[model samples]
Target: MSEPNVLRVEGLRVHYQTPAGPVKAVDGVSFAVRPGERFGLVGESGSGKSTIALSLLRMIKPPGRVEDGSVTLDGVELLELTDEEMRRVRLARISLVAQGAMNSLNPVKRIREQIALGLREHGAAREGRAFDTFLTELLERVGLRRGVGDMFPHELSGGMKQRVCIAMAISLEPQVIVADEPTSALDVVVQWQVIDTLRRVQSELGAAVIQIGHDMGLMAHSVERIGVMYAGKLVESAAVRDLFRAPLHPYTQLLIASLPSLDGKERLQGIAGSPPSLLNPPAGCPFHPRCPFVMDVCRTTMPPPREHRPGHFAACHLYETS
Candidate 1:
């Protein structure tokens, strides 16, 4: 039998109420992340990738609510947990390394103090020398010097600050870590370094990782499986190699084709048109507007997910007839 999934999300729908209408940020999306697995969610900005991350922790703010779906983590239904119960689960079981996390740190607090706060709140460490030693170890695990913890957020480079965030995320040895655009805003060289650090630390702790980002190239290398999201829905999902080798969905194909080749011989192609406005999304398939192979059925009726291969699944009319 297959190992139980560390995290499973089913039919999740997060909508924001506005003067215009309900913005379907995450409309009927579902996927699973196995223990110690690296799952990547890739798409353009406003594709609802980040919204899924926030929903996993039940952190959706006012005007936005999880209208439907179940979020099960380690057999426990996260959507059923109370606010106080979820708070205990946050760092103790699942942690988040948010996008632009470097800037999210308090500028006034020392790095050590910030990290120690979580540990203390969760009762993971005692005060005094025990906490100091634990904090130092956490910093070193993320490839930072132990002494760097004494410095304020402004004192460190962007990359170093990101590392500190990663360290904090792993401090409690959580079963899963949601890293939403952890390497965003950093240079290419620093991006790779941060990715490497994340991979190493996650491996050491045996934690499943959900790496969310717009860069398919980075996701291709960083994750074992990939899920392509378009206009608040998951269009395709498959193993990294399988998805790259034979993408079944038109949107997935376009995304992969848009990436520049290493040899500089193949011309990169860009996807045509912009994503539909979520408030007034296209009637049927959300991607039908920009899809090159869109048919009449696609414009009027939603396509159901079809299994093209053993593990590959795609939601498109083209595969419906297969």
Candidate 2:
């Protein structure tokens, strides 16, 4: 039998209450991450991809709140947990590899201290030498030398700092690891190295990973399933190979087309128009303004999700009639 999902989000709606109006940051988004799955969320900036990640951990700040829906991790309702209960859940069950490694790490603390802080918080540390040995093992698991842990964050390169963050994330052996743009702002070689490290660590730890970023090419190779988000909604979701081979949604097609081809035979195409403002998103279908195949029904009524294949699904008016 197949393993059950480790994380499941249903009809999640996170909105920000601004003075001007309410911004629907994450409107009715739903997806699942199975055990040991590498799930990728891809979209343009401000598409609510990061917001969804924050909501998973109940990390939404004031003015922004998880208005509705359920986030179930290991069959527990995360939204129903109290603040203290959620705190206990954070590093022990789920951890975040935040974007911008330089900012995530403390410039004042050494790498060993930062990683040990997580272990200490979770009460996983043993006395004396045992704790030190465990810490060294964590560093080596992420491709870092044991001595590197003694150096400060400023002493390491961007990629090395990122590795430290990864090391800290898996330090607790959490079941789920959310990596938001873990490879942003790195050179091509460094990007691949970080990706490789992440893959290896996830394999070793057997943790389900949610990798959020805008680069479809990177997601294509790194994840098993891909979900395309647009204007605060999931436009399409499918296995990596199925989505790339036959994208059902126009937005998914546009995003796949935007990726540069290594063979240089295909011209890169840009999606037209800017993404809609969540404060006053378009009615019915939020992507109607930019979708070339939009119909009158698309502007008048929201399209329901349709299963185009065994595991592929999309929310588009064009698929409704198929």
Candidate 3:
């Protein structure tokens, strides 16, 4: 029997309107998340990683809109839902630990109060000590002490603030957690701690997690499957071991090659050339400009996503072997 998927995104396109023109932040991206699966989305800055995350939760603010696509959670299409309806679904069903979430917390309110805000918004209890008890437990579960909940955001360290943010996101027992760069601001030790905590919470709660990170090394250990993104498109996706052992896309290979070795002396060589601006991306394959093995066809026509190996999919002219 196949595992049940908690979310499915199909042909998702997101664009941002700037003074100059429309920026195609996320163009025609598609993927899925199975229950209890830790799916990693890896890419450098400007690859639309965070844009995809925001679009998943319908949190794309003004100047940005999901121009096309269907984001289905369970059996429901979220893109069609109204703002009011989306609010109901945001935390109760599909929660998000967004980038800079520590800054999202209210400095004026106590941690307990901020968490309770989500509970109340999602129709969880707002009154009595019941909510307080739940908040305490969630804080402790995320590696914080119960008393930490009484402090304001300013009182906590950066890592502590992040823990509070995670606690709030999971307090509602959401079915899927979309964590965008969850460990971006932490030290090495704190990063591992947060990843471990996320893994532990995921196991105990049985919720699927979508982890978006640019660091291949961090993702190598945290996720079961990896999706590589380039210039707003999904370049390749495969199971964790397969992706590490034999990445099909040239971009994926280069990304993996850039990871720092345990020996700590070899100079890590990252990919050259900056990512293309979404406002006016390359004509053919979005990655064609940067792909070392780029062929003539890659410069004229976009490649459709195809199964390069069993369960491994890639979008590149190189894999269009008829």
| Model 3 lDDT per residue over 1-25, tens place | 3436789999999999999999988
Superposed Cα deviation of residue 257, candidate 1 (Å): 1.0
The runs of at least 3 residues in candidate 3 whose Cα sits more than 4 Å from the true structure, single-residue gaps closed, are 1-3
Model 3 is weakest, by summed lDDT over 10 consecutive residues, at 125-134
Q: Could you tell me which residue pairs clash in candidate 2?
A: none
Q: Which parts of model 1 are misplaced by more than 4 Å? A: 1-3
- Each prediction's Cα RMSD? 1.4, 1.6, 1.8
Candidate 2 wrong stretches, greater than 4 Å: 1-3
Candidate 1 lands at a TM-score of 0.97
- Deviation in Å, model 3, residue 253 alpha carbon: 0.7
Ranking by TM-score: 1, 2, 3
- Please provide, for model 2 over 18-88, each residue's C-alpha lDDT reduced to its tens digit, 9 standing for 90 to 100: 99998999999989999899999998899999999899989999899999999999999999999989988
Give candidate 3's error at residue 315 in angstroms.
0.9
TM-score of each: 0.97, 0.96, 0.95
